[model samples]
Target: MRVERLVPLALPRGQKLQCELCRGPAGLRCGACCVTYYCEVEHQKADWDSIHEKICQLLIPLRTPLPFYNSDKERNHGLEQQLSREKHLVELTHRVAQKFLFEGKHKEAIPAALHSLRFSIHIYGLNSVELVPPYLILAEASIGLGHLTQAEEYLSQAQWTVLKTSHCSDAIQSKLHRNLGLLYAAKGNFEESLYHLANDIYFASCAFGTNNISSSGGYYHMANVFFRQNKMDIADSLYSEATDIWHSYFSGLIDVQLQTIMSPSEIDILCLPALRFHSMELNTIFIPSADESQQAEASQILNAILDIREHASRQQPMKTGKVVHALAMLHYLILDIPKAHELAMKALLIISYLQKQDSAEAIQQLINLIKSKPFYAK
Candidate 1:
């Protein structure tokens, strides 16, 4: 019933030991395992609580050097061990990178993504189609961190690999296009972004059904582009489609959870979907002039997202803060100054706790907006 451990250590030769959490130079090591290093006791305890406890013993096998082989039989055994280790290392590191990226922890994802890319090259060689997934992960993490040039480099590598392969799967094509779309969008090339996003939608629909949740991301990103362009009607329709896809998926999950007595850990699985739905629904609320009925519906959906987050075990502060900040924006738009200010302050506290200085700017701006009102001046 326990969650599986993932790859944690992938140190380079001649490099000094680094903290498992922050990647800073380290003098401390886990006493029990003595394999993983940390910059300080605090980071050590944090890593232990986050992942090391699950992976401590597992690190021993990965860290131990392979034996020298004398006979042919011994050589074959060593080769087999090497292959096994590389495969495990690539798969686990790739998954860990994906998990961090999904949680919006871009900085945290980079090390795991780099580790995955290294081991993937060891397993499948540099230009193999199998390397595409790790390249895509690195590209995504780079995009999230605003390193567009680095992301473009990784995406170009992926594109080259796909071109070299005789037959690439629709799934990989879909992901490649999605990242391309994201990169172009970040670069403010909306035309190119939309073209790539359209291809992303097509490939995703071809691989998974049109109604599949996997295809919803393309729709969501496309909506964001239209929304930014002030094309409210088109944005609203696209947002609706994305929201419906997520709503249907989460509705099923909520039903299952309601039927069974799920532990806190089990309930944690719903957090990501809830956050995704919250984002789409929040966008829908921004499509300008809404009737009272529409406003009521938006409130209901936002409250449901909060309820799901409330029950989750992890309580992801970064994501939760964004949700609260969005609600503050919604209240401000509706001219509910008091409610907006209260929620904005609450979101600021959460953002500050996570030490996200950039994220707090929007919340501070919202507070400034609330204070600038003529009614408040009196």
Candidate 2:
């Protein structure tokens, strides 16, 4: 019997990602996933003869031109054509994005993920389990690009989306929390990371059973976080536990059912972006009259956005400081005088790091906007 899938294939390691068999420095890769490498045609052919042929047809390509779904009049119902288009668009787009991400081409992956995010929201809606995979992929890609705050938002959305569906298994829930833990760790918030990691361990244990080898992955990560925090005793114990689990599995009591499944990022096609708003409608705000509560709510939203901008300044100071400063003016316009002053101060803090003249001008203009207010007349 042949292997039923071409994916989840592991590549041999070298200075570069290497050939599966020869272990030679290689460049030519399998077109399907762009992962498997070959030193020469002979080695490639040999590998295929040995194992690849069994699973080749089951493999999804890393990237491909978008597939057009044909729905002529005979098969076209009101929504049939629309669903067909959405399915092909989302699936193919996801594949392309995953390819970029796997290759560590983070800059290239970002746009692909952004495009898929929009498609996921439209195709799966807010409540579907289908939304979790792309949301997690977008989060991972965002993390790769050092967009920690964007990653946090994506993780939150993933959690919310998962909660909206009862179909998600404990393993998936564990996976989501694991990413959250990792995200918080990246942001230098180890407390949140440990909490999430612990939850991941718990859920994974529940899903895979206490003695299953697959549950050790969660133990390994949790140990890793503890190791990072310099809690040697705890880390040592967790590491030992993971080792014991693996040793037991190597002794041949492993459960095939407990192995991790291929996530959506691994197998699906890409997603096409869906337009959320009309260009004209976005430019026009309909809230002409605001009550006191509305004003307070708006100020709260501005505050959260300000926090994101401040964090963003660390990565893209010139661009973010300008936006933060402008948002400060908006804060003042909304009569949130204190918040506006804080936002202005935060932007100015970033300005000390910016080397651009235009960025300085934008910050100055933001200052002028705040100072022109009667409250700042002194």
Candidate 3:
């Protein structure tokens, strides 16, 4: 599996380089893109195949320092070229970082995020409001990796930038507050987290209407905080609201897609496959808990997500496997080991068939979890 790919920063000479995939002491570098380092030949090959091939040449400009221009006209033209290139690089790295973060690959996200940060600094100066987005990305990635202190530093910087700006816009404020909320939650400061999350929701609702899909993420995060605090009623209400927003957004696409489809097999394939269950067996092994209602609500939301992803994945088998894997994780979260294992195996089958090494590794981890636990087997 490909590991974290840290872009080289200004460091002391003789410092050991980290591998692009493993973060081990790396001695080998990619011949095509010397900027990428690896601990071994196999890791180098894996990184190249997974992501580097597409970005190799694009990263070349970052490695090259801006040329010196003595003439005023030449300096102006050179700065213009630098700005255009930096903008493109920033967008590319930021998009890649967001994708990794979405897939829960936090370690892998850091390098791309750092690259985005570097380019953003070049394009907009060190303390510009435009740099807030990149800082937020780094903060979220750090939070995902459980680096709370580092996350705090990034969020603090973002907050300072927004505070200094005369008109930072509600959209940016919403995102900044959302990251602050997440950071506080990770630090176990529930009260502070909720306060920030409330601000996040308020600003998001102000920027985008209350019913907009963009505000759904704030609702979802706030719901999680409530769920952790055992405020089930509030959590359930928020979850329903968030899912309802998502369902409406996705259902619109689904309806439009359905109208153009004429094939019965295509429609049939979109229907989620039924999991085999022995009710009597499950009842004997699993006892109902007071939180069963919450679990049921969670299951309902996961099913709705699966349905939406199923239709969306008609042309993307890998996404189907990803959603199945997510469904397995949800079951595991709700303490349904047998069902989690079954769904995991199903996900593994789909991903393995598609020959996705990273996804297959994730499925294998879920299988390992099933084996390591003491849950009753069906």
Local accuracy by lDDT, each model:
0.69, 0.57, 0.69
lDDT of 3 by residue, 111-202 (tens): 67766777788777887998888789889989998998999899889989999999998989998988999998888898999898889888
lDDT (C-alpha) at residue 39 in model 1:
75
Give me the runs in candidate 3 sitting further than 4 Å from their true place.
Answer: 1-28, 35-53, 65-82, 257-378
Order of the predicted models by lDDT, top scorer first: 1, 3, 2
Model 2, position 322, has a per-residue lDDT of 49
Off by over 4 Å in 1: 1-57, 68-82, 252-378
- TM-score of candidate 3 to 2 decimals: 0.59
What order do you get sorting by TM-score, best first? 3, 1, 2
TM-scores, each model vs. reference:
0.56, 0.41, 0.59
| TM-score, structure 1 vs. true | 0.56
Candidate 2 deviant stretches above 4 angstroms: 1-73, 76-119, 166-168, 211-214, 243-378
Q: What is the model-wide C-alpha lDDT for candidate 2?
A: 0.57
lDDT winner among the candidates? 1
Q: In model 3, how large is the Cα lDDT of residue 88?
A: 80
lDDT of model 1, residue 95: 69
